[model samples]
Target: MRVLMRQSAFALILSGLATPGALAAGSHLVSSQKLDWETATKLASEAVRICAAQGYSVTAAVVDPSGHQQAVVKGDTVPLQSLSVSYRKAYTAFSYGQAFDKNTTSELINAKLAGPENGALNTIPEVLFVPGGVTLRKADHRVIGGLGVSGAPGGDKDEACAKDAVAELQGEFQ
Candidate 1:
């Protein structure tokens, strides 16, 4: 069958690639960490729920390590702008956190990039240098992604919701 032929061909390619130095002479495979959709959904929903419990309608977003949005949840009554802002915040936290070798919040990233020389980082479209953004990590401290919340009156308040959400789901990545 055509399907079996394709499978056999794929297996052959994989076996070849598995041999040492079989790939592109000097290049090698790269491994990355990421959150499954179910986990990302749980994280985003929990963030929004925590904020809603506080009488704040907010949006929460989770992004993969590569800065791709994994899941997003918007609390009832949250403004439309909160949606995109949430994603941007998550991207900023993940990207900057990886660069600094630490799980970071937007507040921490902002402070680290405060100097005049680093101001240009702000111009990056996906960079939102504010609180309410924090990197998500596994039990071994490997960052898998980020979470962000917005529309909670202040960035600090948003951050609290984000952190509480992570704490609530601590066992997820373990």
Candidate 2:
């Protein structure tokens, strides 16, 4: 009886660890599909509208889970320089599966596993480290892709425009 009890306890411990890993893997797969084309279009429209309302011509970019650009939008008055940055922001978020923060997170990753030296993150050209880009979240709040808006007053303003874009697509996203 004592040997049987010990065996059962070991099995339970192994099972507990395995359960969490299985759940995490499943969640990751489901969250990835949230970066669909329909969502991207709606979000892009939303960003364009917000920037227009704010009197700032802007460019917006949406990227997939792998950080590939899905859609790009530029307002008539937007500067040509804004287009590249806008695309880069979206790519950054999609590549990292997180929002664009100018802080140490990017630096830390870039130093360790990114850039042309490492042959990873730096693979995408023109991705900016500015704060305007944010990761797109699914119903479960999982980061699926990202939206980036540039050519506004500043990075924060660009971020706001992206948020407004998400708001425009909130119904479909939900």
Candidate 3:
């Protein structure tokens, strides 16, 4: 056992693999920048206001260009359990660059592709499989992220809240 361990360590050192963590500590990762916190906060707040005006009492979530959470807000009336779904909805839109759609409700329900592990709609954990999330696009039509709203009486109403917020954020997003 001792001999095997010594040989393995020697082989790793010889192959320049002794410092595995050094690979992630390079300058490349340090130079990769992300959106500023202030901008993310502003966008999230605007979405919350839109949902509030619609009488939905929703939870709204915003993700960055990399599908990472920028900001999130849950209204007073929104249930605590819906928070994860709201966040995942935003993540799906950002990650997939598309709006949410009900899976089984559609006739084209190719079950193999429509599940969470597949490449179809509602394919992620906690993602609301409804039409209430919108992609945040740039002036050149590049998708930067997504905004998702939930807790409305109807899924359509939730979509409306998302649309309103996106419209209000047009100039800033550009």
Candidate 4:
């Protein structure tokens, strides 16, 4: 047992020396942008407002790239399930945005993943393949989060609200 431990320790030391760059502080640190609370809140509110103007009550949710909710807004009398569905839609948008280069809901809805070949994706608790979701991106086009709107008359209406919200606040997304 002692021999194995010593050999493992020696191997680790030799590997560290062989790759000196791995020991550098910069190599251990990574930097990435995340969606801020203010921006997320603005997105959710704007989506709901846009849908309201079209005579539809809706719930909007914003989620980080990892599918965690950042903010949510629900209009009066929207179905209680709308909250969860909105968040899931946002999560699905972000997830597929990572899988595909494009983050727009139109691209996602048209993707071939709906077939049985990838239909298992729906089994995941946080993913909803519906069309109300859009990605939030940095200026360089890196997706930082997603926005989803639910409870509109149809998925298309919900998608329009989400896209309109993003188009309005894109300046702040960075």
Provide the TM-score for each candidate, comma-separated: 0.78, 0.65, 0.65, 0.81
Instruction: Please identify model 3 stretches exceeding 4 Å from their true place.
Output: 1-35, 98-123, 126-128
List the candidate 1 regions with Cα displacement exceeding 4 Å.
1-27, 106-110, 114-118
Better of 2 and 3 by lDDT: 2
Candidate 1 at residue 100, lDDT?
Answer: 69
- lDDT of residue 108 for candidate 1: 60
Model 1, 114: alpha-carbon shift in Å?
4.3
Give one digit per residue, the lDDT tens place, for model 4 in 25-79: 3353333466688889988999999999989999999987556898999998798
Candidate 1 lDDT, 99-143, residue by residue in tens: 565455655655575235657877888887778888887786667
lDDT of 2 by residue, 36-132 (tens): 6766877886798888998989988887755677888789988988888888877665555443332212332554434555565555565555656
Residue 75, candidate 2: C-alpha displacement in angstroms: 0.4
Say which candidate scores most in lDDT: 4
- lDDT tens digits by residue: candidate 3, 42-116: 666776778788676888888776577888888888988557766776766665453222211121122232355
| lDDT ranking, high to low | 4, 1, 2, 3
Least well predicted 10-residue stretch by lDDT in candidate 2: 99-108
TM-score of candidate 4 against the unseen true structure: 0.81
| Candidate 2 vs candidate 4, TM-score winner | 4
Model 4 clashing residue pairs (backbone):
none
